[model samples]
Target: MRGEGGTRRIVVIGGGIAGLATAALLARDGHSVDLVEARDAFGGRAGTWEQDGFRFDTGPSWYLMPDVFERFFGLLGTSAAAELDLRQLDPAYRVFFEPDSGPSGGTGSPPAPPSAAHAERDPIDISAQTATNVERFEAVEPGAGRALERYLASARDTYDVALRRFLYTSFTSISPFLHADVVRRAHRLVPLLLGSLERFVARRFREPRLRQILGYPAVFLGSSPDRAPSLYHLMSAMDLTGGVLYPQGGFGHLMDVLVRLARENGVRLHAHTAATEILTETDRGHRGRGRGRRARTTGVRVRDQTPGGGSERVLPADVLVSTADLHHSETTLLPRELQTYPESWWDRRTSGPGGVLVMLGVRGSLPELAHHSLFFTRDWPANFAAIAGGTVPDPASAYVCRPSATDASVAPAGHENLFILVPVPADPGLGHGGTDGGGDPAIESIAEAAIEQVSQWAGVPDLTERIVVRRTVGPADFAEDLGAWRGGILGPAHTLAQSAFFRAGNASKRVAGLYYAGAGTLPGIGLPMCLISAELVQQRLREALR
Candidate 1:
């Protein structure tokens, strides 16, 4: 660790994964760190809630990238696995597709005869009651599972070379790629970048349902399968190889461990504290020279609303790291003149859509359910088209996480904790301020439709009646609560242009002593990337201080 003489005083805005990770790292390195979060608690969007003795993780049920979590705790000379019970789920998750209808109007397609290829193998039918449909699913696409395995194998290679070697590298400038070491690796990454995920999968499998199931993750990045880069196939590899995991207790347990690590290392966390303004002192003489103009962030004005919404206080700091939504921090927090990017630049930065989440506590356990389940829409292309067109899809594919299936601590003795999410277009009709087009009814209707669809797929009778408690979150609420620009769940879309160096720089182009980490910045979304973004910012800040 370095001495405190040159130690930078840092304040991080937004206590999301990025903010907390940054604070922990900086503090571990002997820097003075204070984390001011707008929310009443830390964890930002991934926070949790407890109601009537049942606990729920409000956002991000899937915990991928175990390495990111390990690296985060490594900075504090500990490991996340030591504190958190992260169990790798077997059979990863189940995918539910609409039961096939026969030639004219039957419930399912024609049943398939047992294939010689897997005569001795045990068939895994997620939709068991729809046995006839499962056989039809196999019949429609012979060797569909085998093709998926092959696709995943190739994707695993891409993950090894692209994500492990390239994505994590902090490219302060593009000049490094011109080096021979990087040049050699470019060949592998280039092909994947140029190709489309849809085409890549189509070349291997002929089944429409299997194609939809395999290609769905790309939509999380807001890119159509036909448009998304083939490199995105690495996402599937992560799930297939690493396996989806959930922390014991809940996702918030991970947050709690992080907070403890930060506090132990001398990082100060101010919950219920909102940073209203950023105070910067810039060298006027160096303005507009396209050169060095050293600036120091003197302090932040925080509004403490804990005690009847009282006055503000100025907390001093030498540097500032913002893990809040990059667009929100740039457009709303900083002075207009200090925002280097124009409206057009921001307008072109197309963030992906927000999510409609349904948190439910069921009265009794559902034995057939898995820890994670995905109910894909029948027409995925149309659903995506609606989102791209800035309208909520009439029928959206949905995902459900039943943590209680694996961990008993989430709910009471015999109850279950269910979290369902459906991605919808950002509200307010795109060009206008983000607002749900049809308001509460529209969002609720989407949830209701999803519940009905999921219930049918799961073969549950009167599923809605079993719900003991329920809470719904819409796009508007996400925007207001998280300061998301368009209520986007995963930050800007990870299109080819928006990814890598194209993402907003970790440090502001206009503001000195200001840095960014989290989904809205570099390395993109998910817990792993967000943590890496914080590390990248820490490296940049360390170099600047030197």
Candidate 2:
């Protein structure tokens, strides 16, 4: 660890993964760091809840890109394996598409006679190896095995190049990309950047089911594959190669680890504390607007969680990093004049859909369910379209996580932990709670419908009765909990226009000492991106300090 770099006082807003990581990094550099969070607990969206001997992780159940996490821990002079128990999921996840609509028959073999059980149940088990997934793909289309091998080969190259040259680049300036290493790869890079993931996959694969499977990872990027840039195809390669692992407890476990790590690094965390305003002062020499000098951030006005509380104190800081909701932090906490992105600019931006989550503690186990299951309908495109169009898709596809299947600690003996997620449009009005569009009933009604749909899919008609504990969170919760922009669960979509060079930056371009991190900033959303965003902010801070 380094000695005090003049003992800078740095205040970090939001106690999410990004905020915690940034605080820890800054503190490790011998800076005085204080992390303030509005929530009663740390972890922000990755929060967890417990009731009746059941523990449920609220957000981000899947753990992808293990290398990102390993690197983060390594930077702290430890290994993630020593701090946490992470196990690779054998069948990474199970995707159940509409029967016959997906690949059910084996390649070069007679279509397997559908038994009554097989007729009712059909799912492609995705494994860690590309060969295993290719075999499953071959079951649907005769020649798909070879095609997948080829596609993955190309995707691997892109992933490697991106990991080396793109993902870590802060994009704070253009000089980084002007290097000979990046210029040499222009032929491979340009095409990936120019096309959409859907088009790219369709050009390589023929079956609709195969194409959907290949492109589905884009959902994590906050856009349908059709809208996401092909550059994100790297996700498929990363997942297939890096493998999906699960922390012993859940994704929440990682947050707990981060909180402890941050504290160990001398970062103080203030829960239930909200930042109201960013205080700034112009440099003395360039004062009075005579010079076109931007103001520098100095501190934040905060209020503790109290009834009708006003600003309780001004926490002075040499630098401020906000990992809170980008839209809320910029438009609400900072003065309009100080904000580079205006309200109108935010209005013009397209955010990813928020989620309606159902957490159930069932009395009995579901032997048929996998640890991670994705239930898709015949017309998945319609579901995507409905969400993109600002409406909840009727019979929307759902993702179900039964963590109890793998880890007995999350639920009581013989009980199952069911976490179901359905994507809803990120309409600002929707977060206010309503029933205005497409059989869009009240939030509770939607929960009932979603529950019913999942119960049917799980083939447990009595699934509702088996639920000993149940809780639901709609868009309204996202708005209240995370102060998310339009209640978007993820951040901005990875559409061509909203991707790198166009996505939000780590530093406030117009304000000195004001920086940003989290899903909304550079490298975009997901836990891995949040970690990367923290490093990006650290890089910016180091550069400025120097």
Candidate 3:
């Protein structure tokens, strides 16, 4: 299917954010593209669901790194602002800390009786403006404003340097990391990359709350603060200075914009079409010619998922891109002999945490909660440990999103749309702790607990009673729906060893025309990373084609 300019037929598997973006870019570049999704929707993890006059974005609520989205739309000769109607959130979020029983320094002092000294712990409002948040920090702890400014300066530097020199580049080998820009900033970047975020925050701040605020963004990397590299503290700069923005509509609207972009670029997106196996032409078996070259993907064998669907059919292509789950694509779709990473290698890789998402359409509003809220339990460290250890933690730390609080269109009139996410180990065995090993019966109790906790924080004692609509997405759903590797919501963990240059590359080493562009690939996880990954894939494909 080569065209006038020798444009090759490209088959992009999985119509998620990365796939959608990549397909749009490729089609705009003159390739005949077909984007196939397994489910009946285009957005994979970022998919949306609506029921009883309420809508919910199934994944990825917080919109950080807005520049990436801008750049993407800019390349198409338009502005995301024109299309998305973006709005920056002021007082970005609210954080509620579990009341501390022990006195200052954990002196083991006797618990104070109900008195002025034992006041209720007030929730903190983190403003979008850095200076305002710093002031808030200072109010909470004396002299913290100055310390926060210093830390933010360093984070801004790291963010600036990394964005310019590292983020958009492919890192299949050490050559990319050895770039002149990277070398020039080695002194500043090297130490941060080597250090742990926990130590980095602790060294700069004394207050536990301040440390938690600084370290919490690492959760977006799908890792604990202690395990993630201090380099990711750059997220603080993105959140504080760059500002936490959201689409005028919910995230579902953002997805719709992307879909429109792809369609405008002439990408043929097919939902409910599952690619069963990747078709490849063996280069090694061609006697006496190109004997050493890796196998090249010619297309994919796809089958319609609708009822009474017919036999699988071959969709021929010159190049293929799989934006599906990395491990699942490699182990199941591609032939074992043609796989680059071995099963043992995948098994040893540290998978990120899966989350139990409890989405509720409540009958009334939550006045006390902000658009975004984080409830940090007193045992925050233990909570992280439990998730990493593949078990459920009691009184867990969770992130809650109330879109209706900001955009009333997401819910019925006078109602609220609530999304609560609790991180858990991505281990397949961890499903046994819940019901059916899919939606987990334990999720019911977990959701109940979350309602109670949020209700108390909102000063409403009976939040569960007002739940008119409810649903849950657990590890089992991830496995069944997204084909998540170990049911992880975020794909690979951003541990020091598995991050940046060490993350999966966009190009396939074992298959010449095969490429990967998704959260599982380099630049790491998050919507921004997925967008960046698409550009990386396009670059590699162009180089290979040349």
Candidate 4:
């Protein structure tokens, strides 16, 4: 992994998982690395915040794709299980639907019980096992269960071929797929790749409720089931196959271990330092002589804002890797003369929706709750339409994470730490609603509405009073604080045209010695993908140096 040039100096901007992971890998390869963060702490969106003796994780509650975390730690010659206590969750997550919303109780087909005798026994009663729970969700519609089994079988195949073979490959260009072996496999993938999750689910399940249940994961792609490709349904297979897991203590424990490994590997972390601009030096001779020439990055201008009034400093480096939002890095931070994309690019990028997050620390715990829960709105199609059309859903589907219910370490003796998230339309256009310049009051109003909705639906008595501490994050806040374009938390919308290789590449097409990672870059969003983004960049840097 060492570079051809001895001791290459690497500078990483934005100390999120992508930045930290990239710096760690580069440092482990004996490269001199410096990691900079705008906030006082690391972990970007995944960072933790504490108030009134209650601690809450700001973002990302569920831990899927456990092997990615393991691979990252393995790069540092360590095991994640050694530093973090990983626990697999049973029943994965609980899905709550409105009563009598459909013809059948909406649980989809239940998988076979672990024991053969149990499977033979009269439909094991979920209601008997857990009183408050609804009836056992074996498919009521004729042939629906068998259809689902077939659909899952196909999804498993997609995961084996696409996820392992194509999704993980580092495609510098489309040329690699032109190879015979790659082409043959890709030809089989075309139908699945172009197919929508909505169509796939509808083809399998006769009941609308079952279709909605299986189609839920498509939203993780930042699009609706009708819009997101069926290939993405491989996410469900990932969940049912590996099962969901959560690290004991909290997700922050895993972040802490990675940070420790990075520091131990000699990666310098400078927190509370915001990078204002990426400096570059153009070849003047070639420009004056009317010949095409490439420009080289000189360094970065970073502002230290801890002192109220900040002082700016320039740091030189051989290579620059930015894990910050792609649009932000291009338009706001880089020099105007060096801007690669147009203003309209930001508009298109921001058109994607953002979310309103409510982090609550509760006084008492609910015994009936699981580690993760999703409360689907009555009308799934309308809910997503509101989000995509730049309006809040009347009853938006909300996600809740009660980590303390699974592991007592997340809260004190008799409390629960709940992290709630509801996706909302971002500002219709950039530079409006005070977001382009700073925070927006209108966005705050939307978040307050979400809190009220959660109270009425979840049956939390004295919902506001039980909240020991509360924090709200909106698109405006994300745009200002995290430098996200239009405050998009998941980067560019995971639309069919923008997924995988179609996503912004890790290396800049216009600049030399520049690379990109994080939510905005290829492999897309989620903790696992962000870590892989770092690996891709590290691999490219090594090749470039060689």
Candidate 5:
């Protein structure tokens, strides 16, 4: 229902998936929406880069949570199928674990021995069907297939509880959580909430590779298996049973569809327009609770390059939603008095792992690689420890996406589109990226090591030689380009305290009519969560405006 004011002037900051989704939904609610994207193009992290007739998805390659996409598109009076040419990947993804060393330690130095599956140099493909995956699990360890069924059963239950009572509603108040349904299930959920995902999987599976496969999904939430809450075991159910889908063109194609939907819904889109300030006015005697100062957002001050010089303008807004980095929006755009999640508060918080993204357009095919593949280091804890301590792992766990195997449009014929992601510490000091084989030495080294690791793991020895085009985006690029806090590729880690309501609230306690949406303030990380974050913002707007 439209409030007494009827149509409101809303300014949405950032043009990422969250921002685009927010603007589209708000405009549909009879609000006058103006979306400002700092970049020349919309899709912030979820963008595309084209070079020499080859295209690469800049971020978020995997498409899980079809229901979230379905609901998001449905609200816009359309469907995922209508907007995208979607296909379910047959083998969801392949897992490549660290190689086995001989029993006698005849070669190089190492701390620990390889696990049972370490002898299996060949990568294992996790199938879309549960039954097939069960067979695969049985191949790894005795009586483990049944363990997978039990684990997934629990995961599905958790997913159900989250979808019905937890995932959609933002924890703006204690009221939403105090519901009878939630209280009834609190007993069943409390243990899950308190436990860690690593423990959750370890209790079920014995094989190291199986544990890595089940626990690695926490990375999608920008968290480690040991740090993420057990409730997130639901991530397993997302791909293992529900399956993975690729929007035919690419993730960028989905972004284009969102931009089109936003325009169709009467949103005035302004690309290359950066929000300079979050204009606010004092609103005295504020009642209910966030940081204590009380002010209402009047609008947003924006800057855009003009023909002669940079021009500044104010987009008057009755309501303002920032889909930009929460830390950037609060610290850079607002005064200290009005800022929530100030730097001091962020001091104790954990930003997620930074990333080294290697996009390579390689000649010839990569049949050994699946559409999606993960190379897990045998020493998982040591790898994460290295990342946490701001040290680079020599043999790091990496993810590779070969979109060209599925989408011809991403690469030129006879060439493969290879995108690699290596999680590093969130350190801006690592420096930015470079084209070809040149970049900041620190950043380039990570990319170089990642490429070499992929070549060795996938048995593509000439991978580097076959590369026709290459680009690298490091932690510094994330910070400089997106104003990401700590140069984190995603946002805050989804540790126990940082999950759901315990995570940052979407609205400002210090400012009224001001809200935030994205991975930083959220239902949690991943593309699905970003879409859900927009919905949570709407829920806030609906009640606050009404």
Candidate 6:
């Protein structure tokens, strides 16, 4: 609500969630803001596809971390409850443990499963109510009901600490962690920061299925539970305790709201406009030897996408914030000498998992599927290994979102809508997806396998027969369309070193007035994190202006 400094010309590249949020915030702060998108429409990966009365949300299905959403909206002088229809899902999501999932072969010795690992049972529903979820846990493992309560209680403490002392800290300086409140609690965080989430969950629960439920949330953070620091177990409190929810109209509606917020705040949004290069000039005021090397961005070169006849021209800017992939924005847009994060720097980085997104318009009902369902293979470690190693595991762990189960607008009278995500290695060589399941044979194969896997596990025998429409997206599309690094679908993987203060910062190290926002920057992945990244840019700009 406050314009901290005098107005300046701000150019924001990429009209994705982060970009829109950034533009809105900066514009509200009395700046002349312009946002450009390479694609004809906005939303980037958080896009929508419609066909024959079926509407599919291509990305970001689950709405978790409500507090973060409210905070972002609050910053815009609005409220989430006032601006959108939000619902908390009871039986938050269903989980289907693969029937033959007990044997762990590839990833060395996993904790031995409790007896009855594959007992025949209905797909389990994790309820919004903690007690209901406790009963479900107790049904399989005796005494686990009490254990669930204890685990969640611990998760709540960690989540609270993270929200106050970590997540929102911005890491712009070390002072955040050095605060008295943070230092007083620092001793409690040592073990959590040192261990892996997988080990953290295993010590609390013995049941493989229960462990899977607790550990799987790491994927939401774009990491394997075993690889992510145990500090991430805070995610369990969000889904298991805080509960999952959905916007009444899907993330596309959220996109509409973002655009509205940006426009109302004076951000000029440019559709089908792509930034080709970042223009820079030597600082005339710098009376030193390194004057040429100490140049600042003057503007950006934008390409006019007017079909057969268009060229590039500069869009002036006093400051630049790129919500485009940081790797591309730094390596491709900026000159080599001016690049803050050069191509060689990325060569040493690891990308998060790429995804095969399948949007299916099924002709019949899917009573077995929930608004959110997770089909987890027992040998998840092996599947995780295959994905990290660039091999599509035959029995892969995947997710299914059947929004029609809650919102009828997504599908026709008698039909159902399904969005499937199968995480794979971030390799564009996997090729691209196509309409009606007719993509590169490799991409389509992944879709087919995922469909069959869901059918068998969810007990929907005729799943494939009911699919009347299908569309898929592979890693290559993420690379070409979103400029994702290494075709990774969810920015950089949140590995230990790549997390927290170690992740990409919001400001350009080389270009004084240049900044970056989005999943690729600090605070890490997800819609909420990217929103926070935009706020971090605001914070950085304020510091510079002051």
Question: On a 0 to 1 TM-score scale, where does candidate 3 land against the true structure?
Answer: 0.94
Backbone clash tally (model 1): 3
Q: So what's the TM-score on candidate 1?
A: 0.88
lDDT (tens digit, per residue) of candidate 6 on 305-415: 857637777898889899999999988998888887788988888788999999999987888888999988767778898988889887888999999988888889999
Which lDDT tens digits does candidate 1 get at residues 404-445?
988888899889888888888877332211122234776767
Candidate 6 local Cα displacement, residue 482, angstroms: 0.7
Candidate 4 lDDT score at position 108:
35
Report lDDT per candidate: 0.75, 0.81, 0.82, 0.70, 0.87, 0.85
Using alpha carbons, what is the TM-score of model 2?
Answer: 0.92
Q: For this target, which candidate reaches the highest lDDT against the unseen true structure?
A: 5
| Best-to-worst ranking by lDDT | 5, 6, 3, 2, 1, 4
Question: What are the models' TM-scores?
Answer: 0.88, 0.92, 0.94, 0.87, 0.95, 0.95
**lDDT of candidate 2 over 1-546, digit per residue (tens):** 123646689999999999999999888877999999987889988999898999999999888877888888888888888988988886888877654333332111223343433543566778888778888777766788888888888788877777777778777568757878779878878888989888898777766556767788889988987788898888888666556788998878889999999999999999889998989987554546432437887899999875565548999988999999999989999887778777988888888988887788898879767899887765666788899888888877788999998898999998999988888898645533322222234565667777787777767789988888877777877887789988888988888888888888777756688999999988888998899889888878777778
Clashing pairs in 1: 100-108, 427-435, 428-435
lDDT of 3 by residue, 319-392 (tens): 99999999988899987777876577797888889888888888876888889999887656778888887788
Q: How many backbone clashes does candidate 4 have?
A: 0
Best of the two (2, 5) by TM-score: 5
lDDT over C-alpha atoms for residue 345 of model 1? 74
Instruction: Tell me the deviation in Å of residue 192 in model 3.
Output: 0.8
Candidate 4 residue 500 Cα shift, in angstroms, is 1.4
**Number of clashing residue pairs, candidate 5:** 1
C-alpha lDDT (0 to 100) for residue 332 of candidate 1: 78
